[model samples]
Target: MGDTRWLSAEEMRAWNAFLAASALLNRQLEQQLKDDSGLSHPQYEILVRLSAAPDGELRMTELANGLINSKSGLTYQVTQLEKAGLVRRRTCPTDVRGVYAVLTDAGRRRLEEAAPGHVAAVRAHLIDVLTPEQITAVADGLGEVTARLRALGR
Candidate 1:
């Protein structure tokens, strides 16, 4: 093992708090989606991404990248969505070598219905508890982290 530097008490506390808060937030959101929409958090994310895509469709690889998922995992998720009649997979005409996942009208409608409750949950659990300034700080901090991670992929 490489030489390790011990965390200070304050650092340890902050680290643990961050982990706990993230876990709790994720759990709450997942529960909210399950109760309100019969969808899991990841499923909601997939739908949201597809809805935001042009023509409500995205190449499978693009969708996978947006969701930070493996192709096989995305394929499985898409299969489930397809079975639910919310999404469909179509061969990419131009590419001939790729497939696109297209969000159906039903998928759009489901997202529209689920979004309000999801937003309310977010506000209740997170945003409503924070000042606007705190919200900005959190966004900026997280944006920086995301940027750094994406950069590392280059």
Candidate 2:
């Protein structure tokens, strides 16, 4: 076994705070999205991503990667959205084995309706609470951590 290195008191405090804050923030965002649009945060994220893609469509694998979701989970979410008339699935012409999720007109409208409130909720709960410098620092720090985790295939 390797030498056991434990977090110092300050590190522990910071780590705990980060975990708590992340949980709380996600909960708040989820609630807000659900209340405003009957969509979970993950669902909203998928919609947002698809909406930005060319022709409002993306391959299933690409969608899963962008969301960092499992293939089965993405399939489930896409199915649900499909049932709601928010998205449709299409076979990739060039790759018969591939599938694409395309946002429907209804999905675009739903996102348009929900976006304002979502932005408001984000600003109220997060942006408005932090100074610009602190926001930048948080973004930079999280970006670094994300890059490191991605490198490790986490």
lDDT tens string, model 1, 42-110? 789999999998999999999989888898999898998899999999998788989999999999999
lDDT of each: 0.92, 0.94
RMSD of each candidate? 1.7, 1.2
Candidate with best lDDT = 2
**Number of clashes recorded per candidate:** 0, 0
Per residue, candidate 2 scores C-alpha lDDT tens digits across 77-131 of 9999999999999998999999999999999999999999999999998999999
lDDT of 1: 0.92
The total of clashing pairs for model 1 equals 0
How far is 79's C-alpha from truth in model 2 (Å)? 0.8
For model 1 the TM-score comes to: 0.91
Per-residue error for 81 in candidate 1, Å, reads: 0.7
